[model samples]
Target: MNSNTFSTLNRDLLLNQLEEETFDILVIGGGITGSGIALDAITRGLKVALVERYDFASGTSSRSGKLIHGGLKYLQNFDIPVVKETGRERDIVYKNARHLVYPIKMNFPIIKKESYNLVTLKAGLTLYDRLAGVKKEERHTIYGKKNTLENEPLFNSKLVQGSGVYVEYRTDDSRLTMEVAKTAAEKGATILNYAEMTDFLKDANNQVKGIVVKDHIDNKTITIRAKHIVNAAGPWVDKVREKDRPVTGKYMVLAKGIHIVFDYHSLPVNSSIYFQHKGRMIAVIPVGNRTYVGSTESLYTENMDNIMVNKSEVEYLLGCLHDMFPTLNLNIHDVISSWAGIRPLIGEDGKSPSELSRHDEIFESDTGLITIAGGKLTGYRKMAERILQYIEKKEKKAITPSKTDHIKLSGAQFNSAEDITSLTTLLHGRYIELNLAEEEIYQYVLRYGSNTEKLLQTISEYNAKDLNLEERNILAELAYTIDNEMVASLSDFYDRRTSYLLFDLDKVKRSLEIITSEMSTILRWDNKKREEENRAMQYLIKRTLSFKD
Candidate 1:
């Protein structure tokens, strides 16, 4: 078997490996944090295994703002440490996953009644640049009213004073998580999704020695032995910790944030803008043919398994959009798709959801289970390093230092962005006869990086003469993700594997029958299972579009 390829076809073998071998580390949760931990441990010469109840990045990791930003809003609360660390981490993430993590210039518009004046905004950005260790060429720049309006004519010029332009990285958060997990698997870490940890396996001293995992796909229980266990279960960290032992100290505060997507023609903007509205910071980002604006922060106490955007949240975002661009006349009906994510923040007394810190903290239960909770998406690697350091100190075992900062993630073999551009050009030239547009090829390059060549090969080798261009492309992507990315379900392909459900809903709607039929054939789904998968995808699409009353 090819070690680098993570495929659902090898599920039985992977599960058997998990049951038979005693690993040095067992990581719970397949989100970014857990994926990072597994990669870090495996590269350090320790045998590692990871298990996720659902598909990897099925939770917060898939529903983020899709940016590898430095938390610029945190600077308002004087969260200097958070700003500095996550800020500096942006570079490391960009360097490692250059294909997924990209530099985008964000404009912070200055308004007349806003709290930050031109001078103060410039000062804050200057400090932000210094804290982030920003490169000289990408440093912040102050733009006058004329230049600002020229840059983004959609802004409400009546209240605008000026703007501050700075560099922020955008990413496909789910894809990044998958690549990290795949890299871990390549390095000899046994990582499996759809495997739920049911109970802890403890010794006579009540110390966690292993875990009993329920395989959701095959409907079997397997006990995997490990020397160390890490609970990186994002919002479920506390719940997982309770299974090991009772929760004692700091706990997670579930903060729900939602984003609404609009067609580019409906809400056209030249640049990504981060602005303030009624004491809250909102970002309007344009990606591909769609523009997504988000995030209303509020305490969420509902079921963690089903988080949805409510009508009020939708109205709140629409209000912000109206305030920012009065000429656009955007409304709820203009929304094409939406997503909700829960932030597992460390709860603090007298702090609202918006006021909670994004910094991560590690907890060691008396039963010797290590749990990491609360962190920004940009700082996953550092969080992994810190947790590994804590483990080494507590266990008193020497291990190799972290090389992830220099170790490029899977498919990111390019030396620089220019190399990616060159590759895109080369691929488009080679595959021009396939009727794929140059722009489409560039997007494919961005999505799969060097793996685009493999995808192109799959497309070229496909012998479907009856399918249309779009259908062929979708089929090739589905086949590649299934055989290589461990895509076991329809939602896994549409949602996390690619963002067709969120950004390209029209494509999803048009190609649903084809995708479902193809996936059923490859995954060996019987009639009942095929119907279940189809129902799940339809419900997911409806849930994303339906607002809670």
Candidate 2:
């Protein structure tokens, strides 16, 4: 697991991996499921290559509600098996990525007296706890209205006649996506973020073999050869499948889900809330210092890359939140940050998109390309296992069964929570030693777990001039982005490395100068190019970030 194995996702390496070497498998998307496939294949000693048209997790993966639990709502559909499997998988993910995923208790408030009676809510919670394996310490619990208010008084107390039972886990979806990609790269997988699969290359027999790819940064197209190809393109699965000859299987049933991040207190509740909104379930998940109010389910029609939030989606989500928590004064103007992600659902007749199954479907196109469609972030590892099983049976290779359940992700390798705490302490020491503040160390621990040690070492040699940023984000991180992480653009820093724009959009405009200057030094951007990058990030910030007028 030498760090050198991970390299910048630049044009040279992408072209080299594609044209110079024969690959056993090529995964055509860089999201969670695709990253999982790459990790699974490479761990089995298969030569693997993965390419993304945009940044990794730039689509639905990053835009998820960031939960790592079984779909409780799916229970309403009577899909008990899905809930159980996802519960088991959720435990596996919690164990495998302990640093990122953590347990959170959720409360389902029964607003309508007769709509969902206490008996039914209690039954559902009991089933949820059982599906989660009901560890003695983490079993589901119920509370009377008084006890519920005692636990989470911020909840809309007046409207709450009775609230139901509690259970579930919350997570940072973007960080999880990045960590999976990082783990795959550590395990001998070739991963490229800004590389895209343009079309497939077939032999005389018309068996799909490889791909023609374009490096978006350099605008150079190259051919890559592989024995097997996997299409895990998420929302774009339909578009990517168009390249496969005569299109063997139906690709996607696109359902759009939008979430809005509000200022933490305006809608603060200690426990996450899930209630009926227009006959559908919407969750109000509380993460650190913020509340994730989301997820309006609607049919979406547009290219995913260019999809932006219309006024209606924002209004729909806000209205739902208002209905559940009438006391919490919130409107579209209260939206701090908003995003939309398309769930790649299995297509079904006689049903609206929201009613489409969250279950994943695997199809081998007539030309032998495998397209994995549907499923959600919670069940990614399971999805990977399914994909690997298909490849194992098709190739007839005697490979090790999927071991990711046992394999710890990069950040989860700490021997104990104490080790993580010690690393955090070490980061603080280094920051103080470098005359930096304690609060600044948070970002370092977040981006790189123990890997921050390397960043500190690199920064120790630089002077104050090289170690300052416009927003005062430590220069060490920006240097690490250039040296270690393949941060080729400003969006990488603002959107991914730190959620600066999402959290503090106004400061971003003022912070642009320092970031551009440092990035220009590292990325070799000229004055014009640096300005262009700044302008693009500004446009994205204006589009995505919630602002205080």
Candidate 3:
């Protein structure tokens, strides 16, 4: 097996290795943060192991606004430090993972009855560019009402004043997390999904020692000893902390954010927009043939496991859309798919969810377990560095400084954007030769970077004579992910690996049977297990459309 091949076929051997080894760092939670910490530690020459209760990025990490941004909205709150740090970090993230994080132009429309006038908006954007260290060519540009309308004719003309066009990097959040985890595995870090930490192992002095994990796959308990344990669980940080001791100090403030998707023609826009409606900020972004508008933040006190978009949230987002683009008149039925996710923000008194700061805080418990919570997607690498620095201080020893900023994530080895463009052109010619659509070549490159060649090879070498080119292509993607990306279930492939369920539901529906059949053969699922997986995927499809009720 390839060093980077994190397949489920190796699950038993990996679990055995986990039980036998004494690691230097044992990370709980397999989200982006935890994956980053594992990668950082392993690169620094430390023995590391990571375990997740569910699939990797199955929680808040998969459900972000999907932007590697400098937090432009934080400027309104005068969070200059956050803006500066994340701004700098954005450049680093893009440099390291260019394939996953690429630049997108965002239009911030200045409207009547809003906080910023044309002059003030320009000033704010000017300050934003300076703080974020934006490159000269990609900095903000101001546009008057006429230009704004010409840029996005869908805006309501009566309320539009002007706009500021700037740059933000768009990404697939879950795929980013998986790549990080896979890179760590390639670097010799033992990472396992569907493995839950059930208890803590303590020494004679009650200092932290190791952990007791339950392998959900085989119903077996394993004891893994480590010198240190860190809790990087996003929403479940508090729950993991409680397994060791009481969760004191600042706790998590669960905030619910929901986004709705539509066909591109329904809410067409040439550029991504950040517009305000009735004192709330919303993001309208277009990815391929679908346009997704999101993210309403409110205090959440519901069942975390059963989080779904309700009719009221959909209506609220639709109202915002109708106010901004009055001509569209989009309603509930127009929504194609929707997703709801929880933000594990730090609790602050007398502040609304939207008003809360996103700065991450580290808490050291009496048992010596470290818990990290609250931060943005763009700052994950910095968060891991801070945790390592904390460990160095606690142990009073010299360790390696973080070199992750220079590490190109797996599949993102291209030296520059031009390299990716050249690769896309070359691959498109090959795909055309194979009777595949030329437009799809770019999307595959964006998702897999230079690793796309492996997918192309798979498509060419596949031995199915009965399948058409499209089916052969879909099955090749499934085979590649199953072999390299640790795809353990139907949902893992559809939801995280490819994002077909969210952005292209029609493709998902059309490819469901073929994908399920291929996965069943590869994973060797029994008939009962196959039925269970099919029903689970069906339930998810129903959930995305449940808001119509």
Candidate 4:
């Protein structure tokens, strides 16, 4: 049987799998940390089942500032161990997924008066490099004002004293999280999205023996038996754990982070910039043709699922942009799209949310379930190793040490820096392989990486007319998603597969016709079923995009 067929994540299959056999571990949550846990357990030859309540990465993991760097600012607090451990994991992930992760030269603009002074900043960078191990490629480098201006002509020429050292890697958090889950499935883990862990199953001894899950798509209840249960639910960790335990510990304090997107020309910097805006550090990340500037840290009162950008967050981001790049022409009109997510920061009394620790912790309930919390995206794999080690120790199982340090995620295939292709070339190749036109290749490459080959193969049966959609996505890709990627609904394809609705709602709405048409054929949806799926997707699109409008 095809692996795609076996891994189908529709409601019936998920319920059937839960009922079929017991697993060694059942990982609840589908964010990076949970995905990492599933991958680690599966690679160690454990039978695993990983489930997500919503779409994969519909939480803090996807809404990160998208940096995988060792926290340079944390160095001020003397958090050397976090810096060092994150540095090692950063290098490990960058090497494992070279195609997706990039060695970004972050330009920390040194304003003439305060911020980080020259002498002190240089020492910090030196220490950061040392903690990053003895890697030659990752050594820190400082640039003078003349060199900085020459490299990034967009900066305010008058206020720039110079720039700080460059030592970090950047990534698409959503893509990275999804890739980890896909690789976990490839290594023999059952992974399901749209499956919520509603409760825990305890044996006669009140030890966690399994989980009770509900399929969001079909509204069906199911039970999955596991020897070990892990709650890696990102922001929803506390809520998920509450179902299993009495919610004893203060595990998470939700912090809302909002990011605003602008056209590339709006803030045309040659490199990613790290700057201080009202004492909170923000990143101006240049990705493809767009620049994302953001991230305000504030206590969130809303539930994690209902987190949204408020007027204050918009004003805060705009104010930061004005201060950081005073010369740029920008306003709310220049903002193309924006999003917000709640971070599951470890609850502690601090001066501010930014001051909270990024370290992860493991808690074993009176039931045998182990809940891991309070980690950054940069250290998810290491966090997984820690949790798995604890599980092994408790279970008295001798498992091999973590091999994720050297494992390659699915889709990553770049072997060199100069391997990037032009839009035309990329489209031409993608058209031949996936039955898509040249324009749709960007989505394919960004979402699939080298696993695009499998996507293409799944779509090979379709012709040009069947594959071509509204020039952004191909119908073939939609078919492939249903057939291979366990995409149950149009929302899965939109919110997770391509992230079309988030970045460009107008484009996604325009392409929905063809996408639904093709998906309907593959899913064998009748007129009622087709209308139902369309209604469900439209409801979600409205809910997420209505705020901006």
**Among all candidates shown, the one with the greatest TM-score:** 1
lDDT of 3: 0.89
Put down candidate 2 lDDT per residue, 269-367, tens digits, no spaces.
777887775577788887667777777877777777766777777777777777666777688777787777788777655556556656788888778
Tens digit of per-residue lDDT, candidate 3, span 169-240 = 999999999999989998999999989999999999898899899997767999988988999999888888
The digit string of per-residue lDDT tens for model 4 on 320-423 reads: 77766677757777877777888777764434556665578888878777889888898899888998899888878785579888788877666544443443
Lowest summed lDDT window (length 10), candidate 1: 348-357
Mind giving the per-residue lDDT tens digits that candidate 1 earns over 1-549?
544348998898899999999999999999999999999998888899999999999999999999998767778878888888888889989988999998999999998887898899999999888887889999999999999999999889898889999989999999999999999998889999999999999999999999999998879999999999999999999889889876765778888999999999999999899998877889999997899998898888999998988999999999999988999999999999999999898975566656665579998888889999998789899999998999998878774467788888888988899999999999998888788888888899999998898998888867455788888899999989988899999989999989999998888999999988998888788899989999989999998889999
Q: Predictions ranked by TM-score, top down?
A: 1, 3, 2, 4
Question: Would you list the clashing residue pairs of candidate 4?
Answer: 208-368, 411-450, 427-438
Candidate with top lDDT is: 1
Alpha carbon RMSD to native, model 1: 1.8
Off by over 4 Å in 3: 1-5, 348-357, 398-400, 428-433
Relative to the true structure, candidate 4 reaches a TM of 0.90
Pick the winner on TM-score between candidates 1 and 3.
Answer: 1
